[model samples]
Target: MKKWIMLSFLLIYLAGCQPFMGGQAVIDWVDFIQWNGQEYNGVHNSEIADASFIEKEIGEVRFKVADNVSNPSYQLKDGDAAFHEKGTKLYSIKGKDNIIAVKDEAAINGYRIYFAMDNSKYKWHFDDVSLEQVKKIEIYKSATPAGNQQIATIEDKAGIENFLEILSNSKEAPAFQPNTSTGDPISYQIILYTDEPITYKYSVHYDGNTYFWYPSETAILSDDIQHFISEK
Candidate 1:
């Protein structure tokens, strides 16, 4: 009798613990399937099924982006990189290894910092893009790190530790709001996901209309710069 009762309770708990439909777990990707009113064309003396089946698949992925300007280290990819989007002068930095892409330093809106580690292929892949995950980024148009500004210098000793703590405890990547800093009417956002630990850093800039997503990875050469420039 005790065993039966324990088993019953365990089953009930497990049922409630089941993840959301379509494997909506923090680590699993799901595919959506739509059955068309068609038939499977193949037949073994069987009539063609009058249904079309469309399956949407999503894979588990993870991404991370870190602003470690002091560390001259990274893993790079030597692939054909380009800014495929139109109307914007977005750029990307990439190469075959981590160090090749590391340059002396670069500046965005007067701040010199290293590229965020996000463009590598080995770590980041999305089987399906979730419309619900997309967000309208808010760029801090004249916000700067001042006495009363929200932009905090991440270079301090405890700053890095605090940032890492946030990442470890967060269910998703924390969004960066430029409102904390004063700058060239521009701000950056770092997006993260739980599928896989692949990071993509973005700099958002507007030209009167749409906002652009500039890849934050560093380039190995002038040619490499051409690969990651994109507009969205």
Candidate 2:
């Protein structure tokens, strides 16, 4: 009776553990199916099925219907160098053998920083900003005749890390308000892009524009980042 009881307990434990393993497979399958459809349609797609009918292999997996009326589809096609999502033809793996791993979107793409300051009132130009250690930079004016001139580009390594630090350390102010008294007022916008992009904008207040992008705000700006923007 004790042996039978032990066997029953073992069966219960195994049953309990199945869901945990199955949960992970479900998550992986969800990722695989969406990725596959993204490749076929050239647009993002949603997952439609559960983990019930996935077949896992040593280095690959097939997604299929339980009844087997439709043909099974290969979701992951593992290659010697990297794991390829069969549908998208995009590499999901990062690095080389032994050190190989899944790719991180944020780390691989780096950061894109965009700065736009009112050209009419402010004298700053993208040319004035320093880029000694920056990886890549692009400068352009807004298509609008009166819109702010813009600078946008990507950075990585120490350059991006420093920029992130500055942003995090900078002081926060109240939500922006436009100057009603003056028809034209100075405005500024700084946009940083990573996995998620953030925007920071400064505009003149009704009373008077109090924000300064230099000396006071300059404390947040690294000397390696830029030099002069306005005379005052």
For candidate 1, the per-residue lDDT at 133 reads: 38
Q: What is the C-alpha local distance difference test score of candidate 2?
A: 0.27
Candidate topping lDDT: 2
List ranges where model 1 is wrong by over 4 Å.
Answer: 1-120, 124-150, 172-232
What are the per-model C-alpha RMSD values against the true structure?
Answer: 23.2, 18.4
**Model 1, 23-114: lDDT tens per residue?**
32221111111112111111011110111111112111121112211112222122211111112111212331211111111212211112
Model 2 lDDT-worst window of ten: 40-49
Please report, in order, the local distance difference test score of every candidate based on alpha carbons. 0.23, 0.27
**How many residue pairs collide in each prediction?**
46, 0
Candidate 2 local lDDT, residue 67: 23
lDDT of 2 by residue, 20-91 (tens): 332322211112222221211110111101122122221322432122212122232222111223232222
Q: Report the C-alpha displacement of residue 93, candidate 2, in angstroms.
A: 22
In model 1, where is the ten-residue run with the lowest total lDDT?
39-48
